[model samples]
Target chain A: MTERDFLCLTPFLIIAIAPVMIMVVVSVLRNYKVVYGFSVLSLLAAFGSIFFVLPSIPHTIEPLLILDVYSMFFLGIIIISALLVTFLSYDYIKQLEGVREEYFIIIFTSTLGASLLAVANHFVIFFLGIETLSISLYILIAFQRSKSNSIEAGIKYLILASVSSAFLLFGMALIYTAIGSMQFGDIVAALTGHDPLSLLVRSGFGMMMVGVGFKLALVPFHMWTPDVYQGAPAPVSAFIATVSKGAVMAILIRFFFIIKGFNNHYLFIVVSGISILSMFLGNILALRQKNIKRLLGYSSIANMGYLIIILLTGSNKGIQASIFYLIAYFFTTIGAFGVIALLSTNEYEAEKIEDFKGLFWKRPFIALVFTLSLLSLAGIPVTAGFIAKFYVILEGMKAGLIVLIISMIINSVIGLYYYLRIITMLFSTPSEIKLPKLSITGNITIAIVGISILVLGIYPGWLIDLIIRFVSL
Target chain B: MNVFFYIAAVVAIISTIMAISGRNAIHSLLYLILSLLAISVIFYLLSAPFIAALEVIIYAGAIMVLFIFVTMMLNIGLERETEKKWLKPCMWIVPSLLAAVLLVNLILALKNVKSIQPDEEAILPKQVGISLFSTYLLGVEIAAILLMAGVIGAYHLGSQKKKVKHRFLEIN
Candidate 1:
């Protein structure tokens, strides 16, 4: 509320206003091109503002938000992904009928929510950030409501997500009752002076874990992932896979580390168990999936398991690994889904495995891009997934989490079979379905993502050293 | 005031049971409205007149009426005349038990606290407005955005490609 506070909060304010500007602009004279252009530009401006204001950052917006190197990193990832998603949506929304301009409104709004998660410092801000994301996603996930499955996914996501939010509120109530504080720093202060593993605190965190787990699509709470992913528009699914999960990952690190939640014996055991179960369940379930989107959904669950292993280390190295893996995963997922969005026709998205049959013969460039993404996902050699997974495994080993490392390795091998299966399907005799022409925007997103994956895979040391430099500083 | 509050509370409990247990959709909606009205009376007895009015206006009047309109438009369960059975005593056991347990816990919890007196001054609407806009300004802003998003969502979902149904265009 100070002038300095307002100055430091400019990045978030820019993102927040961009959507409203789009709303007013579109209401007066609707143009999809202008809206899309503005949405992407605003996100870029917000991204740039973060760097311009970096010297002033480590800014505390007291009791609600904190902007620091950590938050700035996640904010950078969020904006980049949002920019790419906006580009992908340029073509994806055009494939749909009616009210294309509103798509940018939802996209920018979701981006704002994601960025808030990156900087949230209090439970109230956390819940608001999450609800903002979830509520917008309910509409975006069901964006293609003409499709029955989209509506089904929307309602399912709405009901289940609300239930999870209720659990989260109840957990926050319990924690608030126990500690008499809602800020992360206060909760930690309270717990550090007492027995942190008290029944009240653990139960509160257990419920909160269910809420966060639901968002991340970890085991038992993960049934919605495949259905929601398959049913949503490809660009929206890409947004969910990257930006939403990225935000929550940042939250997980912030919340858990602040409370030292992992130090509790029962809590560690519970997280480790979920991590292992997700690794096995995600991979095994995905083995039989014929839908490319749903397959990616399951693999993302498994990938989350791998990410959790690194976090178990609870070391700076572990955090770095998680961030690196998340970046790699974001690029690969958006690139892969971007290809699908381009191939999506007016009537149907290129969802079915049959839809992708002999894609190599039809469009060799897309097929090659898809191949690299899948290989990266499979953690094959010379792909970003391999390097990312390698860092996580090394981090886990450093923490003596050998069992999880073994399971992850086994899962990745099991992963290779299906990824290869899809690769073969891509190269099989060309089917009659003609591929759609990609818009310039779509082509650029895919190209940037594909090249990033390759460059990051080949030379991860540059980004890692960069992350380490910032993270250490 | 205490006696009137107890009476309203009992009425609310019974009407709520009827609201969910009633076979007819219209009957359920009416019962829900009654329950809400009873709760509003209890709130007024507790000296929160603004909240009491809101309980009636928003919950009983607006939301319940919306539910009634939806039920009438759909006219669901009308064709299933054979299933229009009255609420049986057996159907009341689970919810009644749950409500009883909740009431017991509530009473025990409130045992440590001072009870509200009917003579207490009600919170002024102006105070509520000032605090909302001043202290919780961020909440107000976020709420405005939520409302806008809700409007955008409703417009996107509800507006049809074909505006009105015509006799010639009607499906068999």
Candidate 2:
């Protein structure tokens, strides 16, 4: 490979190398704090690398991967989320004993894998990136082996994920048999001449959708999501909900947009049905959930459904809106989970809704951040989630999906009940239970995310414009 | 040659069934090996000799051996055999139905097979090798990393603390 190839690949390489380097450094010094610092620095460096390499627009490293404005946008999201997660982990892991520094390593590796997925252009790269992310996640979910719930979540994810992988592989094989190639461009070319109703192609496409649908946690395939999220560590749950889903959404947008499958009415109808079902079901189910993490889990499924509305539109505006919404959701969700991570102390997890009761009385700053995040999730004004939902609704309207738009609106209203319930609980009288003190690092992380949510909400013009430019490419 | 194909196909189907239904893990693994070898033969017949070779080397040889070694180390001996649940008959139904349907479809599809149009330039190994090194080099490297990670994972799990057994009273 030439220097240009190396230059184009630098950001990905930096992400991959950072974790191993940190592992080595941790082994020598045996200092968790130092390891945490190194992880944060590496992620920041990765974030900076995206800017440094900004001049080379739309550069393909090979047939397998492309490094462009689209990828850099999501890479920025992943890096920022990883930075926050690492900050959260500094205190989260400190509360538990006998945990090694390998937690950070897994986190960083998963982030790298997510970034790779955002840029993958070939089936092979896509599969590799996904497996890398999922395997690391399986380990991360069960990192606390003594916790039976954690182990159960890990096993459930493994079995379901393996089945999904099989479906995806079968889809790829069928598509290859029909089209003679596995690249996105080639698939599009093959699809152009064929009738959309062909059994082989349709089955292949359906199976592929099923595979991706599992990751996005759409209805029917969403059974494992709540259980897994509820069982995983809070910060890791946040990472899975945001970074993992964001990366997959990016790739999905790329795949659908490149293949131009939205023009097919059958596929569009199916996706629309899924979106509608997920929005209503996710909201309704979350209303009855007493556990905050599982509630957020269902809420995320609903959010993904709303996001898929944009993809169903199959327009440049829709793509831009989806990217913008993903960014907004990332900040809000990560910040929300960051609060949970801070409150978790040595003997118990701050997962129960009762635990968050009277949080405002005890820790006003954290309570305020949590309130803002929940409101944003509820799509209240003056927060990023509101703007995102507005943009998505506008795109849905533009595509003339009136029914879907109505469903999203109704779901948003229904979603308000649970979100407000959390807020009200936070403001109730402080419980006799004492809360843990937040570390400076965790506090800074929360503050940054909180400010980001508000700033993006008010002045989303710049980010929207950037997304529009990237989507046009 | 056609008789060999039929024989291999039957062997593959039966071994696959055994792999799923066998009560013993080691027996299941052995059946899996046999099925993999049969699939490799099918791959060779389909003019994918390189894939056939890799299938045997990677799946039957390396992966199966790893499975056997892990099963052995876990000490799932005859004493544990009695614990096998009565789900064997149920487990065989779905795969058997699937295999039967697939075989019937294959037979129907192959009834009107067209004669091969031989391409003078077609060299299966060379084309596959070239593509592997050029377009799929990253995949090749990633597979190596996967194997390495598997080794590391195995070592990590194996080295964890093992429960100590209590000694009984001396019987001298």
Clashes per model (N, Cα, C within 3 A): 0, 0
- Candidate achieving the largest DockQ: 1
Q: In candidate 2, what are the lDDT values of residues A150-262, reduced to their tens digit? A: 88998899899889988888888888888888887788887886655577878888898888899889987899999999888888999899888988888989998887778
- Report the alpha-carbon TM-score of model 2 versus the true structure: 0.89
Report the C-alpha lDDT of model 2 over B1-172, residue by residue, as the tens digit. Answer: 3554675688788889988988878668867887887787666556566887899999989999999888877765653553344245554454455455435534543452332213323247788888889888866755544443333333332345454554454333
Superposed by TM-score, candidate 1 places the C-alpha of residue A247 at a distance from the truth, in angstroms, of 0.9
Q: For residues A389-430, write the lDDT of model 1, one tens digit per residue.
A: 988888888889888899999999999988999999999998
The all-Cα superposition gives candidate 2 an RMSD in Å to the true structure of: 5.0
| CAPRI class assigned to model 1 | acceptable
Best by TM-score: 2
Reference-based lDDT, each prediction? 0.83, 0.82
